[model samples]
Target: MRTQVAIIGAGPAGLFLAHLLARAGVDAVVLERRTRDYVEGRVRAGVLEQGTVALMERLGLDARLRAEGLVHTGTNLAYDGEIFRIDMAALTGGSAVTVYGQQEVMRDLFDAAESRGVRIVFEAEDLRLDGLTGDRPSVAFTRNGVAQSLACDFVAACDGFHGVGRASIPADVLKVYERVYPFGWLGILAEVPPVNHELIYANHAHGFALASMRSPTRSRYYVQVGLDERIEDWSDERFWDEVETRLGPQASAGLVRGPSFEKSIAPLRSFVAEPMRYGRLFLAGDAAHIVPPTGAKGMNLAVSDVAMLAEALTLHYAERDASGLDGYSARALARVWKAERFSWWFTGLTHRFPDMDAFARRMQVAELAYIRGSKAAQTAIAENYVGLPMGFGGEPSNR
Candidate 1:
């Protein structure tokens, strides 16, 4: 098969790009190693930054999102169970975040792709990219034990961190920066009303805990755990007890406990691959960077990567301009690094370090107290929470 762009992976990054290209009259095909059911079934982050919400509307896929998404104008932070609110919408000129699950976003993208005639190849195994350094590039993969080849003008590597896209870059040409945290988050999804109308991030002597939701009826919560912690040791009763203790009585007063349907532990990390473009291939989403979920920047970061990337590709096709493509790496990395810093900072503020001395604990308390009393501090937090303008400063603002 021949096309203008060969997109690897059918995740949010890849699927979003395919839809954008289709609208711009660019021909592309998406290849996924797993079935659509498997891809959509994976439980992931549930918060959407305004840019992501805007992208959905621009693609004409926001009908369900607008109708069902729970909007939060503010978020809460707790220092030893004394919670303080950060009015994100009021502080950021009416900017707010939508609580919509990443899985739902993928489902909507998939359904629209099928109806809009965006092509996606599922169960495509062993993807390989060739001639990325040359003028033209081609992708090869096997499906159902049969080999296939696709010729394309460019290759988009949205396959993820373990995929062949970033790995295809020469080691000497790629420089990586990463920091793995000493703790992981033990997260659970339960069928119950959330304790509060807005999400809460708590800092306790015990650990860090987050109370969030997928919808009003489905609640998602997480508490920090040591690296050696095991899922088997955490029962529903024990988990709820930890939450109640950490959240303090004020916020936990209305807390409801129920049987958890999904539970897992995920390690946190901050990672980035310098120069997102290597020849004809471009990296977006997890392939290029990862942020700790502390700031809820993982999925939102991926969306912004593609939003900037899609605009670049659109410019190349529509106006015969290569500047956007040439500068894609620098432009996207600028935004990616800011998110990394925020996630790292937020994690440090809320999580108890294995090596945190009393001095460090006091400093955290002092900082939270300062933020509570200072409008300037709250504004900074609110703007970052709502998401920085797609263009950090000098880049184009993506709609």
Candidate 2:
């Protein structure tokens, strides 16, 4: 097979890139190692930044999102038994976030792309890219126990964190930065209703806990702890008690225990790779960078990378202008680093450290108090939470 672009991985980044490139008159093929059902059903980030929603709306992918997603004006910061609501819209000039699962967004993108005749090969394995010379690069893979090869003008590595894209790059040409937190989040999705109207980030001496919901009828919650904790070790009774204790009495008021749909532990980390592009291959999404879920920027950042990648490819194919393609790394990294900083900041604020002495704990409490008391501090949090603006580097949206 031959195409204008060979997009590896059928996740949001690759799917959205193929869709956008198709609309731009570019032929693109997507490959996924997982089945369609698995990719569309995997649970992931649920918060969509304002810019993300706007981009989806423009692409005509917002119909189902608008119908099913919930919009939140702000989030609550609870610490020291006090609750403070930071009005995101008020602080960010009417900007707000939508609660829509990444899986759902992927489903919408996948359906739209398929309906439009975009090629997506699923259940394929051993995909490899080689021979970067000439106009068409070589993509080798196996489908249904049969080997095949694809040649494309450009290759997009949107596979994921453990994907081959990063590994393909020469070690000397890359600089990797990473921070693995001592704890991971024990996440659970319950069939019961949510305990709060909006997402809440709770800080306590025990650890950090997040109160978020998937929908009106489903609640998603998390607690910070060691990554080695097994799901079998946590009983239903202990889980609710830990949630109730950390979330305090308010959470207890509306708490309803139900069957847990998904329960897993996710480690916290911040990782970035310099110069996200190499030769004829461009990396996007988790293939390029990773942010802790604290700021909910992982999926959004991936989508944003592909959005820019799509535009860059369009310019390269249509106008013969390499400016956009040349600037892709710098442009994407500007936003990536900012998000990394914000995620780290939020993670540090909420997570308890083994070395957190009495002085450090008091400082954290003081910082929380100042954020609650000062409009400026609240605005800062609101801006990062809602989203930073699109294009290169800019201030977080104040509207």
Each prediction's TM-score against the native? 0.98, 0.97
lDDT of each: 0.91, 0.87
**Residue lDDT tens for model 2, 318-354:** 9999988898988888888988999999999988988
Give, for candidate 1, the lowest lDDT window spanning 10 residues.
390-399
Give the per-residue lDDT of model 1 (tens digit) for 1-399: 999999999999999999988988888999999999999998988989988888899899999999999999999998776888999988989999999999999999999897787999999999899999998799999999999999998999998888899999999999999999999999999999999999999999999999999888889999999999999999999999999998888878889999999999999999999889999999999999999999789888888888888888888999999998998899888889888989999999999999999999999999999999999999988888888778622445442
What is the clash count for each candidate, in the order shown? 0, 4
Judged by lDDT against the true structure, how good is candidate 2? 0.87
Residue 238 accuracy (lDDT) in model 1? 99
> Which structure among the candidates has the greatest lDDT?
1
Q: Tell me the lDDT of model 2 at 60.
A: 91
